[model samples]
Target: MGIKLDEEKGLTLLEVLLSIVLLVIILTSFASFFTQSAMFVKKNEDKLSTTQTAQQIVNQIEVSLSKNDVKTSSVCGTLPCLLEKKELSNLLGSPITSSFNISAKFADSVEGLIRVKVSVTDIKNPENSSETFTYIRR
Candidate 1:
């Protein structure tokens, strides 16, 4: 009877250890899944923000071109030029808090056509960045 009781106690100990191991495995998998899901959400948000910034820059370029005031000498510098980042931000009624670099150059193929490039870094995430390049003709 004593030996039989000892065998039953040992079996119970083994069952407890196996239960703990199974629980650990399950919890680890859940943690991995949550981490991956969070990363995916963050990537998607960055992409959306980049697209929005590109669209806003393109619109500003179009408006500047429509005014027909952009100077041949102001391709981006030295003269009454199409709007720079600061000017565009002001025109768009947004604060110029973002680090945006804007450049304009005359297009090689078309007279009175300008190529504009806007590079901006996300305010919330400086490491992630985007660029918009567009052509505008007077």
Candidate 2:
């Protein structure tokens, strides 16, 4: 017998096209979300790296101060001790590019207490920066 007119079971061409369009829209939104997530992860990683570098510098300063006074220590011989980009690279034993900056300073208001401020900044992205403040006895 011939096929009946009302017995068709397959999807229509228009329905298939509409489904494909919906699928494309969903996939595009997911792609955008993934891209944004990746960017956020990268920024956070930069922040963590800068923070760890700054902390390492502060630790080194603390250790040096423990062994010797700030005025006579190799790390810093004056109240406002600053390390150039090259020096920072040398100190870390790695190539710290010009995109990064590090600084250390002391507070003058307190006696017998040296307030050490260490800051590391990413030149490319100013928002990605880390600073550590420590108080050590001189």
Candidate 3:
């Protein structure tokens, strides 16, 4: 009877340890899943914000081209161009601005189109940059 009682106690101890191990594994898996979900949400939000910025930049450029007097030249030849936020605001006739840096490069080609590249960086994560490519026909 004493030996049987000791065996029963040992078995209980083993069961308790196994239960603890299983609980730890389940908790670890849940934590990992939560972490990955959070990361995915953050990334998606960044992408959406970047896309909005790109759209705003494109609209400003389009408005500028439509309203301003621009001549089609074989070469850019120092045509008035600006890549700064303040200068862009003045050109677009708007007070809108963004934290992301903006740049514009006019491609000289016989197609009579200007290639515009708008790049927007995530304000929270500067290492991530989203670029939008478009063309403006004269």
To one decimal, what is the Cα RMSD in angstroms of model 1 from the true structure? 5.1
Kindly list the per-residue Cα lDDT of model 1 for residues 1-138, writing each as its tens digit.
Answer: 344554443456788999999999999999999999999999888867776776677776686554344442333433334555666564545545545444333233356455666666666676667777777665
1 or 3, which is superior by lDDT?
3
Q: On residues 42-84, what C-alpha lDDT tens digit does candidate 3 reach at each position?
A: 9888788888888888877776663123333222334434355
lDDT of each: 0.61, 0.73, 0.65
Sort the predicted structures by lDDT, highest score first. 2, 3, 1
Better candidate number, 2 or 3, judged by TM-score = 2
Q: TM-scores, in order shown?
A: 0.61, 0.74, 0.68
How many collisions between residues are there in candidate 3?
Answer: 0
Cα error, candidate 3, residue 100 (Å): 1.9
lDDT of 1: 0.61
| Model 1 poorest ten-residue lDDT run | 72-81
Per-candidate Cα RMSD to the true structure, in Å, reads 5.1, 4.0, 5.1
Better of 2 and 3 by lDDT: 2
Candidate 2 lDDT by residue in tens digits, 23-67 = 999999999999999999998999998998888877776765541
Best by lDDT: 2
